[model samples]
Target: MEHSTPYKIFLLWLLLSSLMLSGVFIVWDIGILRAILQQDITRISTIILFVFFGACVHCAWRSFYLARQALMLAYLQDELVKEGSAVQLLSLFPRGSCLAQEYLVGLYQGRDAQDKVLLSEIMAESLRGTHQVGWFIAGIVIKLGLLGTVVGFVLMLSSVSGLDKLDITDIKQLMQQMTQGMGVAMNTTLVGLISSMALGVQYLLLDRCADRLVVDGVNLGQAFMSVSFDERSGTL
Candidate 1:
């Protein structure tokens, strides 16, 4: 479907951000990319990283649609409430009650059944992607951290094996290697925690927005249904 200008802009932003982040990851590990086909840690990490990146892309797409739906619902609701037609709202329901009619009247605008279904689907997809991205990022970080810890331990143990005959120079070099390994391990954990936290917050905010949109859609539908029936009955 043709999107509004704002929706188009939002999609563009999502695409650009995904591409830029992917580029950064590739450039940062050019050497790893050169040997990406190799069956090693580098290759495995690259695969996992790309999967997480894909999840982010999916989340972005979902967010764009959800935001658009929410905006549309808000506008429609405002228009309906401004008209102040209680009967119009009541006709939207099957067997209109005071509660249903009031609910409909309070809505901003009514939407067709198809539009309501579409909005619901968009919200569901967004929630799925947001949660998936969070878990993927967290998994990547924990795996990298563990790998680093293992490497560090191996280096430290190897150094200890030669400690009895090692000169100060050798000891210093081994200690340095061990320290670097530990740093690598910690860096992975840090990356994972930061990414997960940022995305988690975004997910929650989007989910809340999506929920509101669904409620608004339902209200709108009820109002529209009542109005449609009222017109047929000549009760306007």
Candidate 2:
């Protein structure tokens, strides 16, 4: 009867994300931020930062979305326990309550086969699709950082490629160019790594919530539903 609150995961994400953003702003205010931003001549580091912020926004939205679904699932469980019939379950939830409704409907319509295993597979596949984009974005951000590293190295090496006379002026220019190249490589790599790790953590939280949702959903099916077609037919 005592159900856990669904907002815990969402709230935790907000806290962790806020801390990270706060740290960035604190550093930004200290004046080193400009230098950091300016170091990446190719702007790869800046791009990575922007992309990371976008992913954070997405994770926040998704956390809220998943929490809402968890709440709906809880409500469905309460109603099912009381009414003892799944016939009205679909009507009870919103159209977006795909996980709950689909599971129940699948059970109702799958009377002939009544295969819980197959049904579970279908439900999991649906859930995975919802968060797959987040994973892809996580990976792309890291790759972009690596690309910046390569770009920086290329710039560094290209500066000395035309050296022939070994003049002091030429050497000075080459050294400056190499420093800029090193700056690009180091700054971008740092930005990319930090962004990837931060984004990865947010997605990790999302995955935990998702896993909980699946477990709770499966338990719900087992607790209130029967695999026997005849038994389920009358209830529906």
Candidate 3:
């Protein structure tokens, strides 16, 4: 199977993101999003939720691209088995350019079947680790947002309590404090909710992607082994 260059995939993603960001800015300028944000803490939270949702969408796209690459690599390995020449297989891949190509070269150079299998497993693990790190960062953003919301609530409540002790002569001052406190409190919650929701969705999508990769990798490995066995038997 022919595979498109990773650069092309990245460029596509960048273009998509730019378009999405432009839409977001339009909504912001039109006061639609601002009105929603002003409604209450919940609406603010919704905005936060969607931003992370966008991130998850991007991650899912990445996973799909990675899966395609893995399938291509498997197909290439199968071709190598048919050709029965590791050096010829190496020539088929782009020289010193793609990491996947390098990995295939390493696999082909392995001293034994077990060595090749080990290398494949190591490659899968490395990819999985990188994906997990992205999810971990998303989780951190969520937690920080939650913390901000909590702090905001505390301050808003404190302001309300202080207002209870003030007289009518302090009404203007009390109203100002109340509005400021409420705004701050709501802002934090909005940040937290948006961050948490977005990240949570991304985390889940990434997990699914990882699972799919593992399943596909195993299937590809089995196919490679079968092809190798057939070639060896033909020689005998």
Give lDDT tens digits, candidate 2, residues 1-236: 22586576678899999999898988889966678788789999888889988988999988888777777878888887787665667677666566866777676666544477677777766655557787888888889889988999999999888888568767888999999998888888888888889988898888877777777778777665543333446634
Return the TM-score for each candidate structure.
0.53, 0.87, 0.61
lDDT of 2 at 11: 86
TM-score (C-alpha, index-matched) for candidate 1: 0.53
Global lDDT scores for all candidate models? 0.53, 0.78, 0.58
Q: Please give, for residues 28-111, the per-residue lDDT of candidate 3 as tens digits.
A: 899966765664443435545565656656665666566555555655656655775444444665675333455556654566
Sorted on TM-score, best first, the list reads 2, 3, 1
Q: Write candidate 1's Cα lDDT for 116-186 as tens digits.
A: 46644654454344556555665665566466456555655665777788787787787776665555444
Worst 10 residues of 1 by lDDT: 35-44
Deviation in angstroms for 165 in model 1? 4.6
Q: Please tell me which predicted candidate would have the highest TM-score against the true structure.
A: 2
Candidate 2, clashing residue pairs?
none
Candidate 3: worst-modelled 10 consecutive residues by lDDT:
1-10
